[model samples]
Target: MSRLRPGLARVEFYAVWNEVSELLNQGHTYRSAYEFLSEKKKITMKYDSFRRHVKAQFAKKKFMEIDSQEKSVIPADNKPKRVVPATATVQAFDSKNAVPLSDLLTEE
Candidate 1:
């Protein structure tokens, strides 16, 4: 189940994602976001579909936080142990002594 309409191209998907992200970052609930989108005549998907789409895309895209710049946005327990700089090259995986590396590899 996903809130996003199927058969949408990348551009269409990004359009909806941008709007939804804005709404969510502004402290709107999923229900409220749906209503807002419906009011704007952007999406007609149901609540369940919306929830699924949000979950599906949660990791694929950057999320906006609903907090002021002066405030600490994320909870301490949720923070990443280390932040990777944008310019740094990220290693896909450590192949130090992995067995059957072929089975462990999967392209994003």
Candidate 2:
């Protein structure tokens, strides 16, 4: 059986998460900010939990913008075909009619 009084869960921190993120994004290290808040009785979660939550929030905001050249009709998970000019010719391998390397090179 648990011998603890009623308290808020970690999810409760989301209520003011944006504010916390803003504060941290303003050149404040997690350790210093967390320690200050912890000492001031403003934060209840442990340092590890605080850091994890902060990192998760930050990771969510990161993303890459795909250019028109890289974009395709295919699904985002699937790699798109390489883009080339219309004048470009696609070549195929011909093992039976291979060119000899000696014929292409001659001492001038």
- Which candidate ranks first by TM-score, i.e. highest? 2
**Most accurate candidate by lDDT:** 1
TM-score per prediction, in order, is 0.43, 0.46
List model 1 lDDT by residue over 1-108, tens digit each.
354546443334356988888889999998898788867877666667667777668754433333343257556688558976689676686668656745668532
Q: Summarize candidate 2's per-residue lDDT along 1-108 as a digit string, tens digits.
A: 222233342563575577577668797788877876667767677677778877776676552234443465557878668997688676898878987777678632
| Whole-model alpha-carbon lDDT for candidate 1 | 0.68
- In order, the Cα lDDT scores of the candidates are 0.68, 0.66
How well does candidate 2 match the true structure in TM-score terms?
0.46
Once superposed on the true structure, which residue ranges of model 2 sit more than 4 Å away at CA? 1-9, 63-108
C-alpha lDDT of residue 81 in model 1: 80
Q: Deviation in angstroms for 86 in model 2?
A: 34
Pairs of colliding residues, candidate 2: none
